[model samples]
Target: MPAADAEVLIVGAGPVGLLLACFLGRTGIPTILLERRSSRGPGSKAIGITPTSLEVLAELGLVDRFLARGVQVRSAAVHADEDARPRPLARLELGGPGAAFPFILSLPQVDTEALLREALGRWPAVRLREGTEAVEVRQESSSVTVRARGPSGGETLLRAPLLAACDGAGSPMAGLLGLRRRVRRFPVAFRMGDYRDESGLGPVAHLYFTRLGSVESFPMPGGLRRWIVQATGAEEPEPSFEKVEAQVLARTGQRLDPGGRVWASAFRPERTELERFRAGRVVFCGDAAHTMPPIGGQGMNTGFADARLLARVLERCRRGGENLENLLALYEPYRRTGFRAAARRSRLFMGVGTLRAAAPRALRNLLVPVLTRPPLSRTLVGHFTMVNVPYSTLSGVLARERRLRLAGEGQADEASGG
Candidate 1:
């Protein structure tokens, strides 16, 4: 294939890759997105899109359609105990008094991708090939030729000036590019699922912290809800509708299987982050760059935002230079700092949630509340929302807090509100 035929090739059509293609394609950048799977698999994971991600999607002009098919989550609450009534942890003013969409958006990852692909598919310049797996990726100074097993097992070669690996945690492109990552294990098993619960759980997201583990539930659209349980026994994989009954009984004190199950899977929370996000003409995106425990519910949302930011940076560089030297330098340090900071927090979160050790537990119960209070909590939530990310995330939080506090004779305004 000729070099002109290759502009940008993305391996992975998950939400991150689809988001990148949609954003870049909207700008008339020709891009090809490849997915190993031929179709969208059935399972509901990562439906929690924080307030900051919602803002990002809106800024990209893709939120309206997403919101049309998604639900809004207004608050998240964590209880001292599982059987304890849920208490509010963070109040998401997605549609702040003056904000556009101040609540968190809830939609299955499948729905999110479907809408993104549907939108991006409208653009003639964007092409998405399913049933295509990258057999090899050869990166040179000018371009990379990614050989894919096309439909019916024949090889399809794509030559692209830039290739971004959005290929999830076990990213094949990351392995091919010789990018080594550090993986830290989170010692716990979590059972997650999408189910229907008619019990009035109300507006807040719930996180119940017990010595055994943590279980959380968030209300979503389509009369759907999500529940995650912290498990201790050697149990079945992809937990069944019956398995959630004990948890539902424990949380609601009502009955068995109050909710009809939709999807279920067992996961171990672990953090995997690459030392560098970019190399030569290729770069990493989403889980290909960093993987974190799902505790903070930041995994998919963070990846999606990464795709949005990275695509813009890549597009800017594409306009200026054929060589991505400037782009790599600009993107690396920014992403490294982010992944490092996220890894640190994820480790702490996993350690706390699992609570296998006593010292860490004591330290956690004490530190978490302190960390979540006023300034600390606001900063953390800002990071979680990706509002303090890239540009104005923490800057705005600090700025707004300072302005409000400075105005008060004896009180900090954001502090008081927080």
Candidate 2:
């Protein structure tokens, strides 16, 4: 009932939180985004932005900025590792005339964050407070309050009608809300690094499924290419340029020149989802809500979808003076269903590459060529690009809202006409 610090308080200034704040600000909703990190770190973890997420960026009028800076990867080539040489198995063409964005935009995750931050400058109502971490979250009957510790170690209390948790997989807000999480860890681990593009791969992404392990290569923007290799380890291994070069040469016969290496890291993949995306006045978005293996590049794009829909639903609720909780309640089921579908897709995508055995790998190499041709290739492209994901009926809810608005406008016009 009383005045709050902002209409909405967003915890985390990652891609999801930044985009959500931008969307809310576009609709005239005041928002405050909090980031625990004092500065942006260097990494290109999530690089592929699906066409569906591109549509959302286009709506925000920020797609051109991304397109101008990103690499348009139009296809991905799957190969069979034959001894030290890789034989082409199948190639997936990713875009068509029917699609608004025919190709996936491959940009560094850090660059993506920077672009989002730059776009935030247009939305004066959205405030990004870095080095401010949410220490405590309290959701009352009418408002949600958060106690944050600033860079100076001073604590500040902020309140809002709504709080969005975009704080990532290890989200503290999820813990503060006492939400249950379901986690499943995969047996696989991988090492990936960016290097100078010397394989003549162009903008095509390449995947080599060998008897030893998988080796994936994707082209990047600045004359660099990303290489990911499945590691043989019971524990997570620290990545070295030597490991990458040796494995890549052994599996694909393409030697990586270490002189042009950038950054390298190792990770064990896992899937995590919250029991629910919301708790009273608080709601989870981005990695805070769900996370899958980074294999398919679905993690950040899924969060982009979350921010897109949340923005529309929140704007509708505020403009129509609707019950915020009830509307959000309606929004959650759709997102949950969408996340489940995305998780399954991510699993399938990762599983295909991690096939180590000979029998299954042989079968895959045989079927991939057939599947990546003609009618079937269309479906494969959809799955790879994430354009085929329905993201549930959240769009239908907004569509109904649009129809109601048009009807109301027509009624007002009739009443005004003598």
Candidate 3:
């Protein structure tokens, strides 16, 4: 009978949470977003934003800002160690009959978060609480209560009818809800960094496969380039600018000065997914729902898609007096299917790139040229850009309708003793 604090309570102010807030606020829904960190972290954890995500941002009126601040990658050049010179084995162009923005945009994760936060400033209905960490979450029959600690070490309780958990892979909220998760850790480790360089690569991303391992380079905004090299093993030395430069030189036969290197870190890719994306009134999105390897750069983009879909569902619920529980139930199957497909694709990419055996590697090298041509190349581009990933609400509705029809037919036959 009492009015809740806000219509929706969102955890984590990362891109997914911020974008969700933007969507809710734009639709005139009151939302409160809580973030554990006081500020955005340094460096770009996830750099590649796909075309589908750009389309979603366009709908939110934030694509122009992203385009201005990000670098447009039109093509990808894959190379092998056999070439005398660092020549591309296959150059796959990423522009075709997809969305308006067909190419992938390379922007720092920090910049993307900043832009989302800036856009949220215009939405008066969204309140962001940075440095506020949710310590516990309790779900009642009709509402959810979140207990959070503030910067001054004081605790506060906020209640809302809906909760969106966007808190990343090690999601505390998901843990609090006792959700089951499947996580897979790969043996591959990578060291990556951004450097100030004028590599003639320009808008073209480069991927080099050598006897040592795979090395990837993508041009960033403001004369900067991001380089990532797959490590030999987990016990390999700590990643440094000097080491990355040396690896690039050895793998691709290209000289990259280590000077002006901005940030560098090491990471091992992992795949994680929840059995479902919802628990009562609390729903999960972004890394909270699923996390895949960074090979296709679908992790963040997938999260963006999650936010867009949930916002649509919530907006519909607000307009119509529909049962919120039934509408929210649709989020799990729709998103879990996409997450599984994307994760499998990412694993295939990593597996192919890290083929260690001599015979398979040779065969892959010989077949890659043919695979990167024409129809196959186009398919690969579409898959990587996420244009091929289906996120249709109509499909869900049609499936539901079919189920209802079948149930009705069964009841009729049983009642008539047929």
Please name the candidate that would achieve the greatest lDDT relative to the true structure: 2
Q: Rank the candidates by lDDT, best first.
A: 2, 3, 1
Off by over 4 Å in 1: 82-100, 234-238, 251-259, 318-323, 356-377, 390-418
**lDDT at 170 for candidate 2?**
70
Q: TM-scores of all models?
A: 0.83, 0.93, 0.93
Using alpha carbons, what is the TM-score of model 1?
0.83
Q: How many backbone clashes does candidate 2 have?
A: 0
State the lDDT of candidate 2 residue by residue for 1-418, as single tens digits.
5579999999999999998998998888989999999986666688999999898899999999999999999998898875657788888889966889999999999999999999999988999899999999998988999999999999999999889999999789989888989999999999998998889989999999888898989899999999999998797678778898888898988978989899898889889999889888888988999999989889998898888878887888878977766678766777777777788889998899889888888788888999899898888888888877765335676676678889999999999992
Candidate 1: tens digits of C-alpha lDDT, residues 1-418: 4654547898999988988888788777888889999887788668877776777678678788888887777655555442344333333332334546656787888888888888886777888899999879997778888899987999977898888889999788888777788987755777776777665776557666655556777887888678777777754346655666676566544243544767778787778888778877778888998988877667777776667667766666667753456445556666666656665665655556566455665566566667666667666565545455542133333354567667784566567784
Which runs of model 2 end up more than 4 angstroms from their true locations? 82-84, 397-418
For model 1, what is the error of residue 173's alpha carbon versus the real structure, in angstroms, after optimal superposition?
1.3
Candidate 3 residue-wise lDDT, 270-308, digit = tens = 998887688888889999999999987889888988898
Clash pairs, candidate 3, are: none
Task: Give, for candidate 1, the lowest lDDT window spanning 10 residues.
Answer: 86-95
